[model samples]
Target: MGLSLSRMMAVLTKEFTQLVRDRLTYAMIIGIPIVQLLLFGYAINTDPKHLPTAVLVQDQGQFSRSILGSLQNSEYFRIVHVARSPAEMDKLIERGAVQFAITIPGDFTRRVVRRDKPQILVEADASDPAATGSAVAALSSLPIEGLKHDLKGPLASAAPGPQPFEVVIQRRYNPENITSYNIVPGLVATILTMTLVMMTSLAMTRETERGTMETLLSTPLRPIEVMVGKLTPFVVVGIIQAALIISMARILFGVPMAGGWAALILGLFLFIVGSLALGFLVSTVARNQLQAMQMSFFYFLPSILLSGFLFPFRGMPEWAQWLGTILPVTHMLRVVRGAMLKGVGLAEAAPSLGALALFVVIVAGLAVKQYRTTLD
Candidate 1:
């Protein structure tokens, strides 16, 4: 037994052959690492720049123009909208339409000329503090540098001393910049995505592996009916999990539930159903429980990374953002954060909810088609 090199080599060769024959496993062995490398190396980013900003310029004076020019030059703030009123600017920030908003009061230029220390109100969406941290840090220099060129000759006295004006940065949500406020809400999406997709896929694959699938198909139930019946239990489980996470977020972590429960509940339902539909699609493709698990892992990887649960979604490149947009977890995170932190109503949560609905329809349709194919 000690000297059996030939037999060991023979067994090793047989195992290699078996591995090659399992094409799905072979592909996963090669694909998972490549995906991980590309996502972490190229897609993920921490310091996000070019964040969308809106400006409300009440003073059409030279100083106001100079400050706007300085903001554009900062590269961190990209002026996307010129709001007409304070209400409009507030709406932009509330709806997540803009990350930062700058309001130059009507008397800004006059105050600067009188050395009265004018204030520029800068409102930031601080739901994800990391996304706005650098941009907020960059604002400290704007009061001096923004008006440096304008305060010359007659206004030279204003330039030499303390800052001519003040930039008041109001962090809208999570004013304390609490990390748990962001992470706890996001956990709802991440946890549901991880568990629902894996659980549904494994359950379905288990039926097939145990020969229960053939018995199920022998019954007169249509594919869609069968799919619905199978997914019902997982949906209940997902709801329970979501409720537990949200309760902990409120009671344990002190995460605010700012918006009405109606919006949050509707969004939660849609996201849970959508995730389960995706899992059903994976089960349809997989031949066994192992393959189902691997496929679920593949889905989970991108859902966790690109969906902005761990990293800032806007921090990633355009291509990565586009990839994340298609994921249900991305919209789920938005819906959760918007409701829990931002106090967004049903109207504001509508877009993300619509996206999740579309995902459910598309993935569930594909699952039904694949299940029919299996019947044939």
Candidate 2:
């Protein structure tokens, strides 16, 4: 057919009329860029500061107290817990409750007074090397800087020699400081989230758009069944994405599967289900495909921000951390990282798994309830 200017104008006019009728689409067109601006401008900060730290102070010495003060003043470490024993400190790090654990020796005061090198141990959860790298680097000069006041006069002169105290950093899990070791596992959660949520979130909206939702509702199948059926295909999709990401992580990024296959697989399964359930819940509320897409992006911003994928989970404020706890992404990140890097078993990742199970139950229950039976 020959190109016609009139025909093109007619089609353009039709599209503009349709665009005006779909107010939600217009709102998304205008609002998405503004939201992205705010999200990227205000919410995202990769150089996270004031990471949560724990203290195991075996010495009540002035020098020990000064070191703690310096850590706080550096704005890099926030002492959230004061563990009484090494065992307690281990539990904190293992659970990811604290990013760094500072342990002062009992003889630290005496050794510093005698001009001998006293060692203070700083054990870090190095699973996310970016989270710990800056903090660890800051510790190098802290001992000398902190003791400047106590090292007045004679001790000041001794400053010319080796520092009286040493800050020993024990970077656990990822001692080699591999960035991919942290990023690859997080990619499992990130990929699953983007795919599973976005996929299922459009289920009802797409059906509604195609004018098939009422037909599906007319069937004997319950709302829950329809939701589940629509979600199952996306579950498989999530698994495929996981497999590809995991394979690339191992082959290209040199990421290791430190834990058993079964444990990682189980965690992935639970997390995938939870994400699909969340998407189903979103679909229940969205009136159309555009609204659904917009809502999915709205949920996505927080998932990436508070879920510990881009920044240290503990680095955020207490309220933000608590908010993140409700997100399956946060727990999934912990599970995947622990299993892959820390070589943790299922039991070790039980807390995260349990959280994921709770999220699935709540989200699935809400979705089942939210799905309209009569399509009003």
Candidate 3:
């Protein structure tokens, strides 16, 4: 049946009135794009420089000092950690604490003076090779050039092989430099983040909008019960989401699930709980479904930016990196990547798992408190 012009206009006017009345919706419509613009414009940097580096200096030599100085000057490397021993440095790299490690042999100065090709071993955690590629490349040219400055006169004339020292770059983990190996596992974290947070954020708000919240509250249900009841179903949904992503990652992308299945499953459980708890907390703040959706986006933006998913985590400034640590997704990425890519066990992914568990506890506590307050 053809609708009448007057009736269609009336329906259109009603929708417009509802839209205007919903201030949260209006703000989201206008504010999200502006926020995205600022975030992407200022915060996004693909070619990240000044990656965190660790140094194990056994040589107290002018050549070693010159090499380190040149690395700092290149603006590609920042030596944040000075390890006492090579073993300590390996632990640092294993924990994803440092991107690059420079080991200056005890005889570096003597070798350089004698015109011997002393090898300066540089071990790079090549899990995210793109982040370390430029910095590693800089090491190749910067050290040789810096050595020339110090090795002037007869030393310069006697310098062997055009360069003073050899740089042995050991690209550990994902040596083939496959981009998918880094990205596919990260996709598991990213997809779960967007879906779980957005979906659960709407849970309480939907009940409120439909006027079922009061009815539910009036029942003999405690705040914890209410929160759990709302979240339990979503937990199953999260498991389904994880299953799909993991399966596709294996079959379609050929990303290996090399980590212990127990560790991976446990990490996924903690991460999903934390994400769902975050959504519940968001629901407590938002008065309606629109506000819930908007709040979810607000959290999603920073999570994606600072979580080492899109850009390198070490590439961010100290303040930004600190901010990322507070987000659950940050630890989730670490857990998933460490497990999937490095074949790490529960002990290896312990810190990230602990962080996720902590997040879940804190957020769930807040949600329960807010739920009771709302009930009163």
Candidate 4:
């Protein structure tokens, strides 16, 4: 008649025994967050290197030789292949094999000395804007510098010789090159997605594995109420994670918020909801937490690659960029970072906000529906 406090201790002990057997789950719950953060932070750099360039040397003259010499010596371009004509250059770039192709006009030698300047045509694949930039900077500097040296011609001028045309370049978007401006905002999205999804998926799956889900089903609580209650703690975690991330950006990276805080928070909330709902949907379908984690990772890879985090959005092919536009992370990244760093208004982030909101409602509703009714 009285299985009192002493007897209840036996049941709690049995629960502890079951938890201890699943050490892999316990380790993953504790370890993956710290490990992935360190790895992604240090190892994942979008900046590309060793750009492939094809060279076509038309003239064997000293000036042409010097230009070619400079190109060979520079770290930016690796001359993996060569072309003899403009047609060849076109073929090389068109094949999607080369990042840049430099052509020396057949009359380069004669033109340089005779006209006091010869121009070389430098064609680059703008497909990868970031990689192309470094290559262009190196190649462009060589010709002008070579001409200046030749123009001086052992004569020291009292006045600085004809100041060649200069470009007062003004950089846009990310002017300062501070890692934070680009990295911090993207980290907000990435971290929120990773943490909220994994956390929600694991917790729900745990309830099912323990056979407590049937007990919950017996209660009067509706499916929607149960999902909402399960989601509440993770939402709090998402907000706390956001605050810590922003603080890290401010104190460690010196990133400033130039835009309104309300817009940033609103966009972030939608994005988090979408990602978390995706996890909840996965939990409903997966038989175990491992499958749920694997599913999240499956989505994670493409999100990182196509989300414009490690690559320029404009650099991707039209089809690829169109595919990238569908990811909620992509829209959220643009909204939060562009607004916070660039001081962009909601009018500017309107499209991104709209996309994120749509994703949120669709994912959340689907998750609720799937959790309520079995997919079978």
Candidate 5:
């Protein structure tokens, strides 16, 4: 029981030899961080370009024509559809086909001629607040000179142009158009998906790689209990991370939590469960921790890129937007951002919550089934 320096030295020397013999540790220390840096650099673009748009020209007058022409001329809008009616335009916007829609009323030109306010309705999907800023700015500024020209045409004798009706501008979601207000909501989901999935999967992979999983299975401990225990810590960690991010957003980034805190937390719980379950599936199939990490990153890439986290959901190519629907992170992000920035209730967040619930049920069932069969 007395101090034994020789024995301690021998144990230290043996551990060092084992560590040096295993090349995997050194590769891990050098390789993984490098790959993360490269991926982040390429994929994390904030200033999205070439956003698609749809035009709803209910009015065929000169004022409507000029406004539509401005949008068409801009590099931001691709103008995929020139909708004949409001109903046609609404369908495209809801299903995610278009990033913007300019609705020209029947009185657009007449109002300007009659010296009344000329109205142009621009419905911008402010889901990705950062990218939508440029579009909103351009659209708001569109009717300015055109309306002035129309107003001046009627008043030839007057020295200056009459004041055309004030364009009552309404920017959806963030009326102030704050980027952090929108970005922070989505950040919670992105951070949770990466951390929750990677953390749980790494531990599961660690058990199998280190050969402790076999010993646990041989004992009386049930698979469900082991899994529940494994997940409990991560659930706590995920929630804590969510709180930290939300607080940082408020203090550092000026993001407001406009929605009910309870709703955000509940939705986040479902999101975390779904994400961790997906990681469990990855862990079940992967042969080692490295492979698990690689597989997790594959999932992460599509989720972040196509989930409307890094890119505007409305702005992506049609095929990419369709692919985004397959991931639960995309739906949950809508719920979180909707609640936080839009001040939406459970009614508005219901669809996203339902999607997360379905994804969780499916992934959790598959993971548990695969784990059981693998043990047998």
Candidate 6:
């Protein structure tokens, strides 16, 4: 009675058998740790390199060429676009097309020879400060390294005293580099993603567990009708959550609402629908509430990490970036940040909007198909 080894073994064996039977939970237990290890070890990067840059070199001189070459050799800046004018370069930065823009005035060479200390303008899209920090630091040594070969015995005097040219960095779209400015907008996407998906999945799974789903499914309602009916309330909750977050972002964090409200509203609607649809899909896959929650967490992990919410999106490896791109949260973050910080309009936010719209369609379709299968 005091110590029964046989009884203990029987209970332990039963639990083990149950654990093995629940494949989803088993996978979560084993798979979560390995995924975390791989992502933290290989996918995440703090000091990102090869950032996309645009160049507008008005000066065709030797010194200009030297500076450009130095930038490329630094391995920090990858010159992806050659802009013809200032307007074009600005457009590139605004669209998030380029992280950095280098503009060397036409008189760059003549002024260096005259010791006029010509200024080279470096404009950066500073929305996510962490992404640009290392690259900006690398620019400080460029003046000396860029002009070293061109500055010979005759020009050694000009190079020895101070830098021949000044590198002036213009940090756009969060000039002060406020962390909250970046974090707040991203929170809009993150919060909705976590709550709406988790809630919807749990709600649907609850219906099944309580045996209410059987009664509901017996009705004349179509699969799409059921999905839409279940998801509509959550959509309203998501909207309210978004509004509260945006208001707090403006009032508490002092984040700018620089872009048009139309774009923000459009993005929010698309993202909310997409997130709810994804939740519906998760619910369809899960056999119970616990499994629904586990699946939700699995989805949440990648959405938060790879979506550039916690880290710089471009800072991740190419493969990680590709994975991030598939998540609806990635595009939602872009749309939210673009509208709040960068003043992007519908045209500029088109790509992200389109991506969200597509995600909604695909996920919703899968959810309906899964529900229909259950009906059979």
Using TM-score, give the best candidate's number.
Answer: 6
lDDT score, candidate 2: 0.83
Q: Residues 172-204, candidate 2, lDDT per residue (tens digit)?
A: 988899887898789899888887888887876
Shift in Å, residue 288, candidate 3: 4.3
Instruction: Give lDDT per model, in order.
Output: 0.91, 0.83, 0.84, 0.69, 0.73, 0.92
Task: Give candidate 2's error at residue 322 in angstroms.
Answer: 4.7
Pick out the ten consecutive residues of candidate 6 with the lowest summed lDDT. 154-163
Residue 34 lDDT in candidate 1? 98
User: Positional deviation of 223 in candidate 4, in angstroms?
Assistant: 2.5
Model 5: lowest-lDDT 10 consecutive positions: 153-162
> lDDT of model 2 at residue 58?
92
Could you tell me how far off, in angstroms, the CA of residue 13 lies in candidate 4 after the best superposition?
36
- Give the Å shift of residue 329 in candidate 3: 0.8
The pairs that clash in candidate 3 are none
**Native-to-model Cα distance after best TM-score fit, residue 130 in candidate 3, in Å:** 2.7
Model 4 residue 96 CA deviation (Å) reads 26
Q: TM-score of model 5 relative to the true fold?
A: 0.70
Model 5's alpha-carbon lDDT is: 0.73
Per-residue lDDT tens digits for candidate 1, residues 243-284, read: 999999999999998975777899899988988988898998
The root-mean-square deviation over C-alpha atoms between each candidate and the true structure, in angstroms, is: 1.2, 3.5, 3.4, 11.0, 7.2, 0.9
Model number with the top lDDT: 6
C-alpha lDDT (0 to 100) for residue 204 of candidate 6: 91
Better of 2 and 5 by lDDT: 2
- Taking all chains together, each candidate's TM-score versus the true structure is 0.97, 0.85, 0.88, 0.60, 0.70, 0.98
Estimate, for each residue in 1-376, the C-alpha lDDT of model 4 and write its tens digit: 9669978998999888876776655555556676466435543444545667788887777767666666666766668887877777766664445766777777876655455344576676552345456656655567456445544553224213443212122233444445556777788888887888877887778878888887888788876788778787777788889889988887888777776576688887888778778888888876687867866775676677667777755455556668779988888777767666656666666778899999988888888899778522
Better of 4 and 6 by TM-score: 6
**Global CA lDDT computed for model 6:** 0.92
The best-first sequence of candidates by TM-score reads 6, 1, 3, 2, 5, 4
